[model samples]
Target: MPLNTRILLDNRPRGEASVSNFRIETVETPPLAEGQVLVRHHYLSLDPYMRGRMNDAKSYAEPQPLGEVMIGGTVGEVVESRHPRYAPGDQVVGMGGWQQYSVVDASQPGALRKVDTTHVPLSHYLGAVGMPGVTAWYGLVKIIDPKPGQTVTVSAASGAVGSAVGALAKARGCRVVGIAGGPDKCAYVKDELGFDDCIDYRQHRDYPSLAKALKQACPHGIDGHFENVGGMVLDAVMLRTNPFARMAVCGMIAGYDGQPLPMANPALILINRLRVEGFIVSEHMEVWPEALAELAELVGSGRFRPRETVAHGIESAPEAFLGLLKGRNFGKQLVKLV
Candidate 1:
């Protein structure tokens, strides 16, 4: 029998989860069923979407039950395999929650991709070549469907998903502007990602002024908006969209953690004749292969660059998750457990 150390949800968080909301404990590991595999966690992905899971409120995914191990996607090495398809020493990406070790049925979604790290780092699977990469590609290329010379703006521009969206839009010959919260991220979006312009939302004093700034940068008005933070930023962008513009609402990190929800600016939506759609990357799983292939080629050829913020050790998982919610992480945030 093995002892697995895992993080459990002690109490549901109201706003801004603290380490106290989680309790870490060592417990007896369960026996692997005939189709299961025992995995030792290598890296865990800490993303903004996990914050939505922490609350008991309605969401696209089920809430984390009290006393259950906190859920997350992990890349791991198979230590023992009872399943015929997987074998010992196979490196896999799967949902293993926050733990040092886990037993999975091998039937779950995200069951690893056989990877060769010599071509690209295995960590790329968690960033530019993984879920985030797929979301940006599908949303921008297929959903928004930007035409050449069209103006596209994406918020949260320096984060993993946002940066990828901006880069792909640029590759498609669109005029791209990115909105990030701080000067550092603003500079990175413009100087690194080749965005035509980057707005520092934190520097703006008011919503109207921020709207004016975005309008100034996008003299032609926006043909598309890739929304990540959905409170005032969404409202502001809604006012700036030209007729027939498309909005892909990927996330609402601004109101995550029980922050007071803002009323939607319906007037702008109605008057501008904008088409807005909300999406979950999981829903588009069938389209992943096409997205991944394009992204991999871009990344392998140095046409795409993904920034990662890694925190060492599983013990720092809570802090890493909190940092993601607070916009402290510059890109895809990960916890290295091995």
Candidate 2:
């Protein structure tokens, strides 16, 4: 039997997550049952949403069970299979978790899906062409519903989902302004991602400074907002939004450390009549096909260039994930298992 190395959630985080919250162990792979396929993970996606799962709280999803393989999206190749739909050596993407291998039953709906890696790389499926890309599409296309020549501002502008959102919004002829943490990320967001303007939020720590920057960058006022970092950043954007503007609230990484970070200006939602909606991408599966098709085409054509920050091995996942929560990652954070 082959040895399967797995990372388990050892402790639920009280505030911020640390390396001690996880444990790595090796175990023997059990025999595959009928209609089951085994996959060897090549890459594991580390996302901000995983941080919310670390806390034992009431949310959209249940807290990740203790001492179990940490849940994650993985792109891998099928190594062994008894399922009729999948064969050995087929590339697949699934919820393989923070583990080297996964045995998935083919009988379950959406348990496993085959991916074509001829034009696109396998790891891209875990980042730009996969969940994050779909997330961008759902927020920008469905919720924000941006119009041409409108101004759109995105928080955490250099992140996986935010980067995609900015690019997609720009493609639709919207004036895109990005709010990132540093000069380097801001430069990339403006120069590489083609955002009309990029704000280094580190330079504007307080609401006054941030709001002033937003006013200067978006003189026409923000028509749409793709909010990833909520807290003070949201407050700044709220003050600059045009009347009847729309906002897609995807994440609130600022409050992930158990901090009570409330909106500084909730009145804007009512007074400005802004349409703000929060969403979890997993809840909307119907749009995946349309979103993935457009994303794949854009990525394949070099139009939608999504960047990634990769950690070399599974052991680096803990530190990599922690760094991601701290905005240390440049783009999409990934752990290369192979």
Candidate 3:
């Protein structure tokens, strides 16, 4: 029997998440039943949303259960298969969680998917051409619909979702501005990702300071925004928003640690007539095909290569995830389980 090592949610966080909240265990990988395939994970995606799921609170999705495999997206290859549709050695993507291997029921519609890694690399399936890319597409195209000559901005701009948002907006003829933590990330956003300008939010601590920086960067004012970080970032963006600006509230990572993140000015939404909408991308599964096709083509063409910060082995997932929450990661954070 194959030994499958996985991390489980051991306890709920009080305020901020800690590595102690998780437990790692190794168990015998069960034999695949009919219509099941065994996936050996190569790369495991670590995202900010997982932090929110750690708390036992009312949320859009159920709180991650105690003593269960940590929920995560993984790209891997089938090592054993009982399903006729899935053959051994087939590259696949699925919610294989924080584990070295998973026995997935391929019978489910979206349970296991074979992917083409020729134009796009296998790892890209977990980042650029996968959920994050689709997330960017939904936010940019469906929610914060930008027009030519308009200015579109994104927070956490160098990340998987934010970088794609900037790229797509730039292709739409919109001035793309990004807000990131450090100078290196800001530079990558402007130079590499083709963003018009990128503001280093770390340099500007207070609201006025950041807003001043934003105003300087966005000369025409922000017409649309893809918000990943809330609190100060959102507040600063709101102050400089143009009339009837649209905001897609993808994530409020600032408030993920069981804290109240009140908006500095709720009145601005009314005054500016901003169409601010919070969304969970999974809810709109209907758009995935359209979104993925466009994203994959962009990645395949080499227009944008989403930067990644990878940690080796499953043991590193906790520390890497902690680093991500502290804004230490440059882009997409992942664990190379293989």
Candidate 3: tens digits of C-alpha lDDT, residues 1-338: 48999999999988889999999999999987899999999999999999988988788989999999999999999999999999989999999999999999999999988999889988888888889988999999999889999999999999989999987898889999999999999999988899989999999878889999999999889999999999999999999999999999999889888778988999999999999999999999999999889888888898887899999999999999999999999888999987
Model 3 spans > 4 angstroms off: none
**Candidate 2's error at 104, in angstroms?**
0.8
lDDT of 1 by residue, 130-158 (tens): 88889898789777999999999999999
Clashes of each: 0, 0, 0
In candidate 1, the residue pairs with backbone N, CA or C atoms under 3 Å apart (3 or more residues apart, or in different chains) clash, namely none
**CA lDDT, candidate 1, residue 171:** 87
lDDT of 2 by residue, 1-338 (tens): 47999999999887889999999999998999999999999999999989998888999999999999999999999999999999999999999999899999977998898999888889999888899999999999999999999999999999999999988998899999999999999999988888999999999769979999999999999999999998889999999999999999999999988999878889989999999999999999999999999889888888878889999888899999999999999999999998
**Candidate 3: C-alpha lDDT:** 0.92
RMSD per model, one decimal: 1.7, 0.8, 0.7
Candidate 3: minimum summed lDDT over ten consecutive residues — where? 297-306
| Model 1 regions more than 4 Å off | 107-110
TM-scores of the models, in the order given: 0.95, 0.99, 0.99
* lDDT of all predictions: 0.86, 0.93, 0.92
